[model samples]
Target: MVFAHAPVAIAPLALISLGGLFWLWQKAETPFQSMQIGLGFGLGYFGTGVSWLISSIYLYAEMNLVLSVLAVLCFILFLTLYFILAGWLVARLKTAQRQGFNWVVVMPAVWVFAEWVRATLFGGFPFLMTGNTHLMTWLDGYAPVFGVLGVSWAVAITAGILLWLVQSRAWVGASLVLAVLWLTGASLKNVEWVTPKEKPVEVALLQGNVPQDDKWLSKEFLPTLKRYVGLTKQNLDADIVVWPETAVPAYYDVVERGALRSFIRDAQLLNTDILLGVITRDDSHRDYYNAIVNAHNPEQQYQKKHLVPFSEFFPFSSVLQPLSELFNIPFSEFTPGADDQAPMTLGGHPVGLSVCYEMAFGEELIDSARQADFLITVSNDAWFAHTLEPAQQVQDVQMRALELGREIARSTNTGYTIIVGTNGQLKAEIPPYETGVLRGEVQPYEGETPFVQWRQWPILILLLGVMLLLVWLKLQARPSRKTTAED
Candidate 1:
């Protein structure tokens, strides 16, 4: 899992790791032992895979080393519980009469279902989902139709089949099954689900390279504003010029009272749209929003709906105020935007916009993305500077692009400023942690991938339907026993 997730990003490692873990689960004498093995696997998997979490907590959250390490351990343990659950389930099933069927079919089902649960429950953490590891693999074609979870299903099933082959040596049957699964995806890769617009839109994605700790400092605010303004002016030739999340480092009113109008007018004069991120206030409602707005048309905006946990909003704030102060987190109370809000129109094209962590939640982006010609995610990843988190985030962005079959423009404050093509390939990129503009052409796509139309329902229904059918079959196979009360 660690090798497959990021920085390393080796796809086959995930398969080998999952298969080996499954083998251990089957080898365990009892489900309880299987769960213990799974707990260890989880510790290794997430402890290394998401090691970047320690960087974020230690740096931005301002937590002490002991507390940060403990906090991260708790998070890893939480993620590991799901793996333990899978292990217990697989162990019990592997002992069933239909051992071959259980290992090949039921195990994958268990793994993917757990993934879906992890992705949905507790506001979702959809990271290192395994499916994204296959982004460049033949199985990537499954994304547009089945979504990331579905692709994960394919990987798990394949891994299970490989495990079966190792034990049974039923080479022909396994080969045939693998051939069908893989070749089908290979064919699907060529099917263009979305058509491009007549004219491609030019985009200039700005990387501000602002230090996270210095972002909100009063002295740095004007310089940050000036940096973005200068960058936008230089890139006004683009159809849309974009700034990273919170590039202004100030509220809407603060910028408006200073340079907002002139900035908008400058873009308007050039017939360009500046899509930039900033904090917006609703004074009457006392609401704060992490938002992206069109400088040329402020009303054209998208407020981020999916907020990062703890930093965005404390899960149980009333009882956690002391914890919040200990961490020194900011923007902990920003209001989430309405789901049905209109997509932001940027550079004469409708855009599905995501901010920072929200890119990991595909459903959060899908509603607007279905109606959008393209997608743009503005993020401030400086909190995770010099870590795999940003590149890992890019992997998630690629998954979204492949799922939706639409080009994605990713703008970030610290690093990983890049454009992902509809095929989930990097079309263009600006070097990480650098101050620069990545100029690229995004072809607006006109149709929806199956995923964009149904979100995660197909995968869920398919998984649920299969398990239900299997349950019915198992019930039918059981012998009937009649019991009578003795007189």
Candidate 2:
């Protein structure tokens, strides 16, 4: 799992881990022991994979280093229960006793289903999902057809087959099967699912590089706002310009009458459109939203639908709000936007926008992307500076582009402001912790990949079928074992 994340993402290493899991399941003498082994593996895998969380807690939350570590441990332990459950199910199904069925069919089904549950339940922390490792691999072609979970299923099944070959000492057969899988994936890469719709439009993505400690400070507010304004002016020739989440560092009403108004006026003069992240308030309802708005036309806006847990909005706020205040966490509450909100029109094209962590929800993005010509995501990653969090985030954005078959413009505060092509390949990027502009032309796409249309339904149905079949096999085997016991 650690190898599946960024900086040193050798994605193929995931197969070795999956193979080891198969071996563990085969060797365990009891269901309880299998679950224990699963728990131990989950702890180690997630502990290292998401270790970056500790940096965010300690640096941004202002928690003590010791408390931060303990907090991360508690979170890892809670997530590990999912793995434990998968192990118990695999054991209960007695897949190990079913030759030619356990490793190939049952194990992969169990593993992928567990991952799906983890990504769906309890607000979901879908970080480091297995298929994300295949971003640069041939398996990435499968993303458009079945999404990340489908790719994960493919990897798990391949690993299970390799485990079977190792146990049976059939190295030649394993090599052939592996070659076929890789070759098929490579061939799929050349298939273009979505075609270009309009002429390419030049875009300027700004990386403000604001320090988290000074971002919200009253003394630094004016200077930060000026910096972004200056950057926009520098790239005014582009058809569209973008800023990171909370780039304005003030309420929409407050900024709209001040520098924001000037930005709108200047953009209109240049025949350019500007999209920026800001905190918006609805006075009548007294609700605050983390939203993106068009500086040239504030009426065109998209509020973030999916909010990050404990960061944008705390779960069980009535119980956790007091504890959050004690820890000095600011801006920890936000209301979600409507699920059916339309895409914003910009630069003669419809744009799908996601604010920071919302980019992780692929299904949520599909609705907006269905009518959008291009996709845009804005983020402030300073909370996780000096960690792999930003790199992993860039990868996730790349996957979204591939799944939707649209070019993506990603703007960020303090790192990885990148432009990705419709094929999920990086076109341009600004270095981390630097103030710079990523200038590129995004070729808007017109059509959808299979993933955009079907989403997770196909994969879920396939997994469900596999589970039911395994249950039937177990039931059929029960009577045979009883007869042998009677004899």
Candidate 3:
């Protein structure tokens, strides 16, 4: 699972790891043993894969070291329950034939279903998904057609095939099948599902290397705002300029009549449009939102629809309020934006805007991107500073661009200010722990990929059909087993 992530993402190894998992499941003699095996593997996989959670909780939540570790463990243990259920289902569904139908069909189907459920339930995590490992591989071509979950289904099916090959020792047939699958993926990479709609627009993405410990300090707030404004001033020639999430540490109302207005006036003088992240509030309603606003027109804003759990809003605040107070968490409550909010317009082009963790939900972004010419996602990843979380986040953004067939401008606090092309390739990026402006031109794309138009329905339907077929086969075999017992 560690290797399945960035910096060492060996794509093929994901197949091997999952195949080994299925092979181990085949050895379990009882349902209890099967669930145990699944839970153990899941614990190890997620425990290492998402270990960065510990750093985020400790740094942002201000928890003690031991409590942070426990928090991470508890989260992983909850996620592992999905795998345990998958194991129990597989054990119930597997027929007497250990190596043929169950290994190649039922097991893979159950695994993919389990992954989909994990990504759907409880507002979803969707991190460290198996298909993310194939970002650089030819299999990534499948993204536009079937989305990430479809790619995950393909990977799991291939792993099941590998398990069958190992058991049957049919190296030649297995080799042919593997070669055919990869070659097909390679061919699919050449297809273009979306085209450029407008001339390239020059963009400047600002990365403010703000220290997380000092970011929320009262004394440092003005300095941090000045730093971003100064950095943005250096690239006013760009068509659009972006700031990281919550670039203004204070709320919009608090800064609107002061430094923020002056910043907007300066940008307007240069004939540049600026979009910056800030906290927005509805005074009459007493509601707060994590949002982005156009510097020139503060009225034009995009509120983040998908709020991060715990960090943005505590799920069971009534019950966990004491725990939050104990940990000294700031900004522990926020109301989500309306679900059907439209894309914000900037510089005469519709821009799909996502704040921080909102970009993780590809399906939700599809509506935002339907008429958008380009995409912008801003984040303050300083919470997970010095961890792989930010890098993995960049990769996830790249995949979203590929799936939607749109170019992405990702602005972030503390690094990885990037411009990604429609093909999901990095066009330009700033190094981590640096304060700089990544200047680049991104061509606005129109039209949608298949995944964008249909979303997850196609893949979900296919999986459902497979599960129904398995059930039918299981029922058909039941009568035969009874007849043999009577004979």
Candidate 4:
């Protein structure tokens, strides 16, 4: 299976998991064998997922290389615990007297519930969701409405149907389901929720290609500022221009000194609003924030609500502080911004802004999108370097755009600057590590989606209702079994 490269690593991982699930469905004949398959499957799924942790530790922490490897292993093992429990639950349900629930409901239930556990347990690592693999295909239409969780549901249901076909000769039913899904996808293909109004807003995204090593150093600050300003000057006619997070090393208050103020004044004079990420001091004496300052109105500012653990803000600092000091990365003490701040208006258009790490959290972006006309995410991906994470991250961003029916102007410090339309289409993008201004005209869109109206509460209630009905029916079928089990 490993030698067959056509299916890829994640496919192998899923296949291993499917093998374990099949063994569970067949009654395994022995508890040890059932648990053994579960363990192997859990390792396959998590071991591949945690490969990025090694890069994260090495890049973010100055830990010894060997220690970083060990950290990756430990993190993967820790994540596997959730999958292990999920495996055990599935096996238990199979062993129960309820034969009807064995494969039909139990498999899908455990799969969806296990994914929920994966998303929320241990501070949540919602990356690499199985639904993400279908992003390049017709299944992407389901993403805007259901988010990743919805995609996961479809995947699990398909898997269940496959199992049904194998056991009960339900090929016709499985084929019908597949046909309906494809037809629904086709119908959703051109169903746009919002129409663009007025002329497109021309914007420029400046990618400085700045190295993370020297981004914050005193000597590199002036050169970095000059590079961004030079790019901005070339595209000043654009309605709005943006720079990546911390594109300017100093805070807005600090940048007022010397020629910085004059440079900004020129930008404002050009009648274009320039939005750039800046570090700023809050009312509290020692508190700092990773924030975006609006040069258009001057008074309007939006700060990042969700801070990255360890990199932006440490959760358990008392314990992690010593380990952080070992890295020696500067200005890492970041404070979380208010969750209720209003979106900033640039060139008469409301722009919902998110700093680097905030993009990882879908909830915050969804909330901000509701109140704003457009979406803007500024990030510095120098930490991830040339890893597949950036590409994967943009895919998630596109999903958010489709979900919200809003245009996004995503600016990055190093590379992968992208603009996504409401349909999850890549409007414009710069090549990774390319140093240039990606100038494009993005039209503002308006309207609401099902996701925007009800959020996930409706889906949650529906799932709960199904579970309750299933349990009640099981109870009605076998009153004696329930009594004996309780006894």
Error of 1 at 135 (Å): 0.8
How far out, in Å, is residue 88 in model 3? 1.1
List ranges where model 1 is wrong by over 4 Å.
96-99, 259-261, 472-487
Q: Sort by TM-score, best first.
A: 3, 2, 1, 4
Q: Please give the distance, in angstroms, between residue 314's alpha carbon in candidate 1 and its true position after superposition.
A: 0.7
Kindly list the per-residue Cα lDDT of model 4 for residues 1-487, writing each as its tens digit. 2211112324434434453375465576554555565666667666754465556567665668887777677777776676667666565555356433455566666666676677666566766666655554566676667666666566655555566566566577667886777567656656776777667888998899998778877889888889988988898888888988878788777786664788866665668888877888855648888888767656777777877766676778887887776555566788788988888887678778888656655655777888878888998877777665676677667767876778888999877898998877789998878788999978887777766766766556755675576666655666696688999
TM-score of 2: 0.95
lDDT: the better of candidates 1 and 4:
1
Q: How would you encode candidate 2's per-residue C-alpha lDDT over 1-487 as one tens digit per residue?
A: 6776686788768889988887888778899988998898899888887888877788777887787888889999989998999899888876555533577778888999999999899878778888888887888888888888888888988888888787776677667777887788787778989998868989999999999889888999899989999999888889899989988898888888885777676665667788888899897646789988888777888898888887778889998877676355556788999988888888899888888888887877888889999989999989889888899898888888888888889999998899998778899887899999999999988988989999989889988998999899888767687688998
- Backbone clash pairs for candidate 1 read none
Cα deviation at 31, candidate 2, in Å, is: 1.1
**Candidate 3, position 181, lDDT:** 72
Stretches of candidate 4 above 4 Å error?
A: 1-39, 95-104, 121-123, 166-168, 283-285, 469-487
Candidate 4 to truth, TM: 0.87
lDDT of 3 by residue, 305-358 (tens): 898887788888899877777466556688999988888777678888999887
Which 10 consecutive residues of model 3 have the lowest summed lDDT?
Answer: 323-332
Q: What is the lDDT of candidate 3?
A: 0.84
* TM-score quality measure for candidate 3: 0.96
